[model samples]
Target: MKAVVITSPGGPDVLQLQQVNDPQIKDDEVLIKVAATAVNRADTNQRQGKYPPPKGASEHLGLECSGTIEAVGSRVSRWKIGDQVCALLSGGGYAEKVAVPAAQVFPVPDGISLTDAAAFPEVACTVWSTIFMTSRLSPGESLLVHGGSSGIGTFAIQIAKHLGIRVLITAGSEEKLAACRDLGADVCINYKSEDFVARVKEETDGKGVDVILDCLGASYFQRNLDSLNFDGRLFIIGLMGGAKAEMNLPTLFAKRLTVQAAGLRYRTPENKAAIVKEVEKNVWPAIAAGKVKPIVSKVFPFSVAAEAHKLIESSQHIGKILLVPS
Candidate 1:
């Protein structure tokens, strides 16, 4: 088997494609011959030695992949050999083969190719868990997603709109803002030029948003608190801005807000499996019906995974970036 390994904690240049032994599967796991995998910010952080995979997880740079089942473990009854599937993984996606728990694998949704399916799991689970399940965002309630043009942001907008939620989002450029608006975002704030808190407040006539899905941790912390309506929930899944920030207890108490920060990579397998199952149930129908779809920014050959990492670091892409095995 061939996989991308981080030679050192640094930049994209540290990634090296090296031959490694084939993975041995547990009784509840399946061996997948990977067709494609997608990039995420976590992959970059791993390369830079910032975020480490959970104990006993693959130490590779990918978090999700779409693949074909080459072999199934004895205890795996839900899937069989040759089943085409997409999986939410805890690492080791940047490879030709990966052994994954059967519970975390899902049948590719209708109207999607195996290659494109690689981009779905991580973002789907993250957005669904944070915005819908955790925050309980409902129809007619306004929700704000930071990084509106990102892979998660793009998926969040479509899903929220499909569920009849009013979506407000922030992006870095007009080009990105236009792209998000086309995806059904009610208000698109250019974070580079405008104050998103003000934009969101004005859009809601000072009522503030019911939910905020944030990626910039501390950098936007105070402002995020200020932008939420009473009883609003703010979920943070990424910390691109910085990890530590001061919180305003006065604003928090006054707004009656809930603030939470979370990540998927370190979650227990059972926890991840539950999230995957719910995503397959709740989000899949919309995808199967063509009401929602993945936005792929680019696809690169897996042998050049380093190039893919470079692109992700550049942060110029509007949606998911996929890496296909060469």
Candidate 2:
């Protein structure tokens, strides 16, 4: 199999295409012939040696993929060869083939293209797991998402809207904020031009948001706390801005806030399966109905995986940047 391997700890240029042995299928796994994969922050981090794959995970640098099942393990019953599917991977998605637990895979809906399905798993699974599974965001409540035009943010905004939640988002620029508004964000704050804490308070009539989905980590930590309602759940999915910051203990105590940080890859197989189950039940229906959809910003050939990494690093895209494995 051919895969994008990290030649050394460095920039996107470190991602090298190399011939590697095909992953062997286990009794409960499926071997998929990958069609496409999406660039993620984790991938870039892993390429740069800042993040490494979890123990026993593939050393290849991809977090999610969509493909056709080429073979299934003897114990796998839910999927078979030739099934079009998209999956959240623990790692190793940037390859010609991957063997994953059957429980982590879900069928692509009818009429959805394979490449588009590739765009779904990472962001959809991330947002669904964080907001619905972790935070338990309910209808009519307000949810704020940072990096509003991002793959996860765009999906979060759409899902929050579809579920009847009030959505607020903050992006670096007005153009990105406008994109978030188009995706159904009720309030789009230009973090550059406006103070998000003030804008959020104004929009929610001083109540603040019920939840916050953040990836900015340290840079937004103080403001994120200030922008949340009492008992608000703040799920931090990345450390894009920085990793270290001081927190106001009094503010956290007074608000009774919940601050969480996690990555999908480090989750247990059971946890990932549970997230997949939730996505299959609640989010899949929305996808089938065209209510929630993957937002794809661009597509690059598999050979240009390095350039794709640059795009994600620049935060220039409105949604996912896809790599079609050829």
Candidate 3:
């Protein structure tokens, strides 16, 4: 088994490809021969020694992978050996093989290729959990997504559009805004040139958005509060800008807003299983029907995972980036 290991993380250059022991599968787990993995911000953070793996998780950097089941545990029944699947992992996705809890795997849709499926699990689960499960965003309501050209943002915009919600996205450039617009964003605000709160207000004709998927934590704290309508819910999935913004109590008191932050990897196995199940049942069908698909930015071999990390860290990719286990 080959995997990318971070030897005292500092930069992408620190990632070393090495042959390691294959993971041993538990009775409740499955052994997957990984085909591809997606590069995530979490992976870059881990490489830079910022984000550490959860307790008992593998030290490898990847968070999600698409692969074929080489073997199934005794307790597994829903799948068999050679079944194609994509899995959401707490870690260890940057490897040739991974032993994962069977509950965390989902069958790839018919139209989705094995490599492309690697991009689905993380963003799909993140968007579904934050927008539908946590925030409870409903049809006809307005939703704002920060980092609109990001992997999660692209999926969020498409999902919101499919659910009949008004979508607003914030990006730093015209190119990013245009990408988001093409993905069905109703309003795109160049955060570099315009105040998103004001633009959101003007677009909504005064009422703020009903829900916001925010990645810029402390920096957008006050603005996020101000951009919410009465009883609005804000779901924080990442703290990209920084994590110490001040809150306005008066604004919260007046609008009765709810603020919640969640990390998909920190969730319990059962919770992730539930999310995977739901995504399979509700989201996979749409993907099979060609109603939804992730926009792929690029693909790189597993040996050059560092290059993938560098690309994502540049924050210039318009969509998901895939890394094949070559």
Across 1-326, the per-residue lDDT of candidate 3 in tens digits comes to: 89988977698888888999898898989999999989999898888888988897888888999999999899999989999999999899999999899999999878988889998999999999888988899999999999999999998898789889999999989999999998899999999999989998999888899999998898898899899999999998888879888787989889899999999998898899999888888788878877678689999987888898899999989989988877
Query: What root-mean-square deviation over C-alphas does model 1 reach?
Result: 0.8
lDDT of each: 0.91, 0.89, 0.90
Question: Please, what are the lDDT tens digits per residue for candidate 1 over residues 199-262?
Answer: 8888888989999999999999999989999999999998889989998799988978999878
Model 3 error, position 250 (Å):
1.4
Tens digit per residue, CA lDDT, model 2, 74-109: 999999899999998988899999989999998996
Cα RMSD of all models vs. native, in order, equals: 0.8, 1.1, 0.9
Better of 2 and 3 by lDDT: 3
TM-score of candidate 2 on Cα atoms, chains taken together: 0.97
* Candidate 1 Cα errors over 4 Å, as ranges: none
Comparing 2 and 3 by TM-score, which wins?
3
Query: What's the C-alpha lDDT at position 138 in model 2?
Result: 98
- The reply for model 3, stretches above 4 Å from the true place, is none
Each candidate structure's TM-score, on Cα atoms with residue i matched to residue i, is 0.98, 0.97, 0.98
